[model samples]
Target chain A: MQKSYLMAPGPTPVPEQVALRMAAPAIHHRTPQFSRLFRETHEGLKYLLQTENDVLMLASSGSGAMEGAVVNAMSSSEKAIVINGGKFGERWGKICEAYGLEVLWLNYPWGAPADPAQVEELLLQHENVGAVFVQACDTASTVAHPVACLGKLVQKHPRTLLVVDGITAVGAADIAMDRDGIDMLLVGSQKALMLPPGLACVGVSTKAWEKISQSDMPRFYFDFQKERKALAKDTTAYTPAASLITGLHEVLAMIRQEGLAHLHKRTELLARAARAGLQALGLELLAPAAPAASCSGARLPESLDGKALVRYLRDTMGVTVAGGQDHLEGKIIRINHMGYVDSFDIVTALAALEMALHRFGQPVKLGQGVAAAQEILLERYPS
Target chain B: MQKSYLMAPGPTPVPEQVALRMAAPAIHHRTPQFSRLFRETHEGLKYLLQTENDVLMLASSGSGAMEGAVVNAMSSSEKAIVINGGKFGERWGKICEAYGLEVLWLNYPWGAPADPAQVEELLLQHENVGAVFVQACDTASTVAHPVACLGKLVQKHPRTLLVVDGITAVGAADIAMDRDGIDMLLVGSQKALMLPPGLACVGVSTKAWEKISQSDMPRFYFDFQKERKALAKDTTAYTPAASLITGLHEVLAMIRQEGLAHLHKRTELLARAARAGLQALGLELLAPAAPAASCSGARLPESLDGKALVRYLRDTMGVTVAGGQDHLEGKIIRINHMGYVDSFDIVTALAALEMALHRFGQPVKLGQGVAAAQEILLERYPS
Candidate 1:
């Protein structure tokens, strides 16, 4: 109805430039123009995935890549360990179990980081474990995992690959797949990359690729070997979702231009500003108290109607934020500071939150949250 | 350097209007705006597919939908009849075999359509042929199969389902799914609909959905059950490719505005023009003996190299035509008259073919092909 802001964890507001590029004339995949774009995106995806592993582009959502990571890299009858603290974390176990794999999942309380110790214990205990799956950031938890710590365990068990769903963490979080020793790092264009969600970018290590060679899994579309063969020519094995790839080419170019380090820092600053604003508003964060952070979250104040507040913000103000899921539903609200976020956006979100709370009969000091958010913004990036 | 033209069968050039819609803005999948767009596209896809079956959307290529049809509708152990007449047709057998299914293929030469009688014979002979899979128009052969006729046989069997890949034929061909008794028909946005690829739409009948209820083939990403469940809410089980979905919505509006009959007629007229132009150019069609009758398949002249000629048109004159695959490679060239085709486009393709042939030292009369194409266009439309 209006110029909307997607303050969700993913499918975040896309850049105008990326959208324009997607609208660019489609090039035949077999042609040199497409070949060049495909090669660059493939290379850029690997770099974004931060791995020396061969990167594969999939014309699917982030979950498709997650399913692809397990099915192609491990036999269906094999066992795998997954961390289930939130929706996406549970997704790994669900995908593995659907394939008849024996899954050892360490389920943590929602809104808490997946305990690495428990994951390590599960990995050591599960004799049939062929892979260890974890999401670097669980949007449902509003918490980021210690992937560098988990990567160490997977490095020891070379046969058991550590797969990370970096949907919410790829560009926003500091992930160096090579340095962190991640076997399969999965990402999509929609999240922190500031593009749409039609493309899933997966980095597959040599170890993961070798597992695929022996896998008898019945996969045709997500078959890593077939995709690898096509990737060699900088083309997809099957017809790809072309416009999304075109959009990604633009988004990747922009990312390269902005520099990964700079984007990460910008994202972190936005997250911090949001967190500071919520604290100043006398709200508790839904996430477990820890140094590890992701999207800023705040528990709904007792006097504020969470649903009504969020609805009012969306309808009256033009700010769209995500409400809590599962157990945390109706108890907290999440304001995503990922994808193309800057200090101004952080201040705007807080200002909208203040207005919505007031409209919902939870009257607060005028400009309380915005003032604090602006204070953090000035501290981090002074005007 | 110039605006590209995608002439591939699938992933054809996307409409500029649709691209503009995609670039408009992002919205959350669960939001009302996205749900509205998703619902519109779903309903529009059903109309285009001409099936009462629920049309499900997947964030993958056409191949993913092909995989979904095979894996979700039938188990790995069942006997299935596969038709392998071209590259895409071969995929039916390959995916089935990969899944350990006992396949009885009615193999025909790649360039020709498999006879429906042969399919009937195979079904009669096989003890337990659970399903049938085929491409309505195999892009590799540029030939249209008698899907309606094949559906008749499978319809009589009742136990056997007629699954057709309408990926290349959906928006262009006249294979009405419900009218033809097609149980499952799959298509992507790239082909006849003139949208960039990224979303694969599958129309599954109640029978197919019933099989899906009990299917044991392991699946998570391309899970039809999950998608079907989410369809009830007019949203996806997971985050959808919003921008691509947005683009698809706009494309559907265009298709609806043009009406299916009008679009199909336009395609037919252009196809006839291309065929006439190729004939006037004195080129032999590889499949002329039993031509597909839709896409013109011209055999390379004796002195002209097909691959080099294709490159010459693309590089020198900015025309992108498809070269053949596998056995057909470098032996023939394909001119598509599917999406967004007009008499002028036919003229451009004819001119490019003539120039490429001249460069390759083929004997050709100046402007002969273009003139013939124009004459055919005038005669057909009386303008």
Candidate 2:
């Protein structure tokens, strides 16, 4: 019998304990039992986000929260500076345009991070800028932007807010929302939270609330102001994904036990090991300059079919990794390093990659990448 | 040791097998395995909705789907007729008003159903009427509107489509979308679907699609057209709620095994027994005119503290039933009869309610409600 290993960036393997917790009987949302769990989960979210701001939990995927951030924080009269470095970055521009906001796009290569200096120059040029939208880590490109740097630049502009989609970065990386001047920080449950893809938590600063109050954008289900009012009473404006929230409570407890510093350190180490393993296999890094701690992308050999390789690894070998999207499709493979993953998980991924490559007619030495990954991962256990 | 019971209107108890299936390791959503599961789940949704139309699964609560139905079906150039019978019905008007659509509200009492003749009159009077929104079963009031009758009336008006919020009705009651000429039918996973919150399924008729094609309402996360395109390829426009979808696959299979007619009959029987039980305890029915099969609501005695009684049942007696919402708050109690609920569950709920009322000085006879409920529930067990 073959075993399956989930090594994707966003829908990483959920911890068994957390999964079981979510699997428990469903509870009524209006009861005090739910309110207690919600309150605890909200506090856990704040700790995970490294912010004292109000973190509102939503019932949709992360994109819904991204849309809420736009409609809540800005009006059609203002301009939105969107850093389009990858698919997720481009989504910010699309969402802005969809909401009737004029978007000034700063286009960057797929594997490249957004330059904070360029963003600052755009902010200085556009006087009516309401917000600058960027991804702390874009899962599509596996690139981590200079969110803290961009946060610093936008905080100086009193009317402008910095909204960062930390879907792939929040629990894995150490970007402090309040300390970094992030007006709105978004987190998806699936990625570093080690849960499913339903709950989206957004940490909103007081400055962001001020903007939200003034913005009369059309919204109902994802209404931040209404949710805020409900949060004061320890409830959500609408029906929450109660099971996911329960899972979140358990996961946040796990994160707290591990501590943010240790979690970030472990994640960075895994990312480093993944990068080293990929490099050892003679594969070029997709985001070598600023690789995200959540996952790592690497270019396959020009002759090899990366799409076929990924499918083969998944279907034949039972090792699930992600291939590239858009322009990079059929040319790259991405291996995750975040959430519920450990040193051996990285080793298993590298080993699977090596075997898949060899099977695909590439002259690859078996165990070569694993050896390199082990060298970096060994630092976790100082013996 | 105390045993807990979940007897709420929504978020009913999940089947043990379904919960265990969902608790399995998370799978990568972009893979072929997930695509197969998604395709099967989509087909299951169409079967459950009793329609051949495209049933789109969304990652939000039922309200989000209601908003999508409003924004996708009508533009600002047209007027919408909203049946404000309960809290959910009022939400239709709110969503319409939020999106700048002119809403013609047909206000009814909290526990009353919308009149189809009234809706027909509005359609006849309004030249540019786009759609009429009503609920098949409004959980708040436990009222089932005459959806099929309204469908026949709305179908006569080509420009006016019928949108039914079947959140509590789709799997529990008989709603033939295609046969009834319903343009849009929405379902929430937490209700009759026997899954947790986070997934909302919408079945759209060809008429609704024609309207959606012409509508220019701004939307991003809940974009129906974009989702339709992705659904054609066995995927979603954005990242799906993967775990919930996986659970849906199992739940739909269970629904298929228990034929639709059988399921509907069972739900109706349970609802009738619940009403009988409450009546036996000398409580008035909240929606005697048109009680929904998904749940049953009953008014508490004026002298009894309904809120305190409900809290006591939940906290002290380990039973969870929902208190009323808005004006009905602390005056009524709603017991669910949908999803995985059976005869014993009904007996347990009524018994607990009886004991709670007695404890609150209502002089309720212990097991009096249970005896009444069992008499009606006895039809299921014929020798």
In CAPRI terms, model 2 is classed as incorrect
Q: Where does candidate 2 chain B have its weakest 10-residue lDDT segment?
A: B374-383
Candidate 1 lDDT over B1-383, as tens digits, reads 12244454555666556666776668878789888888998888888998777898888888888888998888755688888888898898888888888888877776677799999998888767778999888888877788989988888885678899988888887879999988889988777767777788889988788877877788778899888889999988777878888887887788888888887776777777777778888876655544543466777765557787788667655568888899888888888777765544565566556656755667775356665665555433221
DockQ of each: 0.01, 0.01
TM-score of each: 0.51, 0.52
Residue B349 alpha-carbon offset, candidate 2, angstroms: 52
lDDT of 2 at B88: 94
Candidate 2's residue-wise lDDT over B64-84, tens digit each? Answer: 999899989998899999999
Angstrom error of the Cα, residue A59, model 2: value is 0.3
User: Model 2, residue B91: displacement in angstroms?
Assistant: 73
Could you give candidate 2's per-residue lDDT for residues A1-383 as a string of tens digits?
12377898979888878888987889899999999999999999999999999999999999999999999999879999999989999999999999888999999998899998899899888899999999999999999999999988998999999999999999999989999999999999999999999999999999999999999788888899999999999999999899999999999999999999999999999999999989999999999999999999999999988898999888876778999999999999999998998765776687668767877889877556765775576466432
